[model samples]
Target: MQKNGFPLDELDFAILSCLQKDGRMSFTVIAEKLNVSIGTIRTRVNKLIEEGTINIIGRVNPAKVGFGAYAQIAIYVRPATLKDKVAQKIARLPEVSFLAMTSGDYDLEVDVMCRDNDHLVQFINEISKIEGVYQTKTTLYFKVYKYAQPDLNLLK
Candidate 1:
């Protein structure tokens, strides 16, 4: 498979599959499972990291961690030119979990997590204060049924 012009083989996919299951999975374990040498697994993982193909990070469930309010906010930025600048400002917010510029009625979309309803209200007030923000529509997620990474096996 080609990723950002870098060629990746079956071994690479296998290694990624193992890592997806458990980010902290050891090179020794992956090597044994894939029937390859430990050095090979280590080298491949390093290469993947350097190429910006993947990052192993601890995933957290917001609800379990006391973040009870989850929301998606659609922002309308006037003059359009300030969209990038506005996005940069929003991205710095710790409560913001995801932010993207899209083509539609709104210029930007943001997903945020907060401790509760009051915290969410405060967050909205904070974002609304940003310069160039004309308006915003916030949608609260009552429940998230599924949240997961893409299945690497599909690449096969």
Candidate 2:
């Protein structure tokens, strides 16, 4: 990678593509799949980590963890302040599983994990009370039949 974040090379992109799909895959496994030495895989993985090209993390299902009700809250900010600040507040809220800035009528979208509909309503009420928030729309999840799986070829 270049100092100013140059586009990744084939090797770097390939490594990222693999890890993005399965963060917990062993270095040896990756090396074999990519037809490279384990040492090379280890070194490249370390570089990717340092360069922020990849993040290896443990992901858990909120529903399986006793938070079955999920809500997607679309927030309309009065003037749209720094998302980082709002995200910090959302992160501190245990029920907030995911949050992101968007490019539409809503300034931010928050994924919340709730125990029930009451929990979801209470959380939305609390979020609406945050400073600078004008309005919010919530979408409740019914049945999520599928989970996200990254396609490595997109990066290629």
**Model 1 TM-score, all chains together:** 0.94
Q: Per-residue alpha-carbon lDDT of model 2 for 1-156, expressed as tens digits? A: 453465567777777777777878899988898899999999988887887767788877777878768878888887666555666777689888778888989888998889998888889888777777788899999877766656657643
Largest TM-score belongs to which candidate? 1
RMSD of 1: 1.2
Question: For model 1, how does the per-residue alpha-carbon lDDT over 11-113 read when each residue is reduced to its tens digit?
Answer: 8888888999999999999999999999999999999999988998999999999999999999999879999999999999999999999898999999999
Off by over 4 Å in 1: none
Minimal lDDT window, size 10, model 2 = 1-10
lDDT of each: 0.94, 0.80
Q: Residue 99 of candidate 2: its Cα lDDT?
A: 86
